[model samples]
Target: MDRTAPPLEVATATPGIAWPGLPGPAGTSLLGLLFQLDRTQWWPAERIEAAQRRQLAALLDHARAEVPFWRARLPGFPPPEDAAAFEAAWAALPILTRAEIQAADASEALLADRLPQGHGEYREIFTSGSTGRPIRGVRSQLWELVWSAFTLRDHLWHRRDLAGSLAVIRESGAGKAPYPDGDTQAGWGFSSAAIFATGPLFSLNVTTPPALQMEWLRRRDPDYLLSHPSILARLAAEVGAHPLPRLKQVVAISEALAEPQRKAIEAAFRVPVVDVYSTREAGYLALQCPDHAGLHVQSEGLRLEVLRDDGTPCAAGEVGRVVVTPLHNLAMPLIRYEIGDLAEAGAPCPCGRGLPVLNRVMGRRQNMLRLADGGRRWPLLSSGDIEKLVAAAPALRQYRIVQTGFDALTVMLAVARPLTDAERAAVIAWARGKFGEGFAVAVETMDELPKSAAGKVEDFICEVPEG
Candidate 1:
């Protein structure tokens, strides 16, 4: 064994083997499962689906037996033990909506009978609740262990230098920055941290000014930086004005990342933008393929579906609603749950990963633009367009576009200085070009852009009627 390598025994080690100065065997064993799954990325797609079906069968059986909500709903449901039979039964189960889950007694959804079997203590987690009321759910230690495993899987898959720094800018209650530990034994908080060395983790609140964020990052000079797409876009623009020499990788999460935004960040930092698909309720769902542009579904952790409006499966290249079924999550199973997101289905990846592919995650439907012709579209804004807009208006700090009616549009901005008449006219002209010539463009200055309840900034919003 390499002396300087991660100071832990391999997964193939004997059952009771333990590292001299690290965590115990149980943590290593659990982490080893994730490491094992990391290697299974290239397993044939059918093989992965089969394993997922087996997991689904167990989840269904548990739900029917112990979950009061599922039991009452599935009174005739002793789903078959076999994979195909269970799949059919699973398909027959009604789709679960966020509203329905919120309306139902949350405790009734839990597998109470199985709680005492050493699955680890259960804890309540509230969803980000970006749209309406947040849905509350329970998670077990077993679930978190699996979650940590998947986190390790992402690290291994990306081949990140375990010793590099990871800086993140996100939301917080206390509005404080968590300084990174400069010690060599510092870990990234994954289950594998005990075995492998990890770099320091630095975090800042997203509410920090872009100038301050750049100053802080340049001072720290970290290897990787993580933030939401909107903020990253602003940071990229900031970096364009002031460069950072040490930042190597960009990890985007929380909000939907558009291709233009990814390109902007990559070009700004001269590094790859690794986008992760995840939610607060469910753990990591998929990650950007290391060798490819699209995402590789974390088949080991989730069973994802791209379905049409009618709930039928969508074909490759078709855009549809994203429905996810967490293979684990025995505490509160979210089977066939519509996460209220949209994505484009992708064909099998040439990288030889049988994991399902998503060509693009288009974000929430609420972000679409309403055209004057009664059509809704998610406009693919290019980097050049953004550059032109900012060039025309140097005072522009942030902006939001909303389509209030068929032909009327509103532009809200938080500016460093007031816009000149020519700058405002140029902005309106640019908006007219992108949206349509027939629409009326109204520009208004604001003290700040209003964020959603979950602290997300949507670049575009449409209020058109949906048939």
Candidate 2:
């Protein structure tokens, strides 16, 4: 429960150990920037904007000069650019969509020259495709440095115990263990280990059942828990009956989290739920504000725009599409890339941090349920909704709801035993009350619900035709 820094003995226990990729010049630069951000995050809004404008001008110059795609697109553009010229040209550029990025020639998008010194290594990142299609991206070591700095910023902002055991549950590769063993020196290869000693790290596949996951967490007794929103909700439901006494905090990432889910986790575990908004392609987008429930954009590394359907910027409390430009990613510049996500813009935080705020992340549009009247709305199901069916049928282990047609609904259930007629009737009745009797709901027993090709588990999917 102590959020203070680890004891001196723990910090000095592994003095020479370093994280796998953070040991050379790049690592030193990353560590330096992390320390810089620790101070810059407290600066005034105008100062932060000035720093962003400087980075923007440099990135635009690099893109126009060396990137083949941008060179052809921006014919008359010359290198010696200032913030004013950069802003004017950037606003005039068309928005880039996922399909275009996916179909475009990679060689054209990649910078053949002008890469930062000692930043030759690049890695390809892919989207989870929870929405409709998956897109690929390229990022260099310099880009990774920025990502590491932002990650450390998150750790510092939360004041987490550096020596506390960390537990993660997500999709894993084949033959991976439920609790992978750790090395003594690296202590589970945490980023903090590169600078200071860290506690052990344990992980298991999210595909594991709730009962087994509870057993796993109970054994580890971790101080911090990290996993996707859906898995965390399922684990919270299990913990509601039996608590994990050592659990101090929960970190939810990669999926949209509803207020009800947050409340359920907090009530069950009695710990704060810190949500991180990020994408696989763009790295860290926004982090949970320390003083508020909303997210503060990582303005130092990325430029974000929340715009309405007409492409104009959204004002305070307005919900619009999220487009991002990662300023530090020079391997492939994603200028005004539409990330196919929606978020509500928020007023500036009262916490004195100049970072922009996002009131809520509503997730991908394809996931919304379609009404019989041809209207789509996000099905705001609470923990109570899941508990209603689980209580009615004690044999139910897990469940998923999918809307296959305007009037057709399929309820997939993973159960220890087949549901009795009375229990099935109770589930049908609960669905009727929640989704209206107009929907023809059917119960289908299965071993488990299907996960996306990218390994994310979607609890709800709407397959109805959309205009």
Report clash pairs, candidate 1: none
| TM-score, one value per model | 0.87, 0.85
Q: Per-prediction RMSD in angstroms? A: 4.0, 4.2
lDDT (C-alpha) at residue 227 in model 2: 89
Best by lDDT: 2
lDDT of 1 by residue, 361-410 (tens): 98876667765566567766677877877887879888888888888888
lDDT of 1 at 195: 54
Give lDDT per model, in order. Answer: 0.76, 0.77
The digit string of per-residue lDDT tens for model 2 on 357-393 reads 9998988766678887777767667778877888878
Model 2 ranges with Cα > 4 A deviation:
1-24, 74-89, 105-114, 179-185, 188-190, 240-242, 370-375, 383-397, 420-440, 465-467
Name model 1 segments beyond 4 Å from true. Answer: 1-22, 75-86, 105-113, 178-186, 190-192, 240-242, 370-375, 391-394, 463-467
Best by TM-score: 1
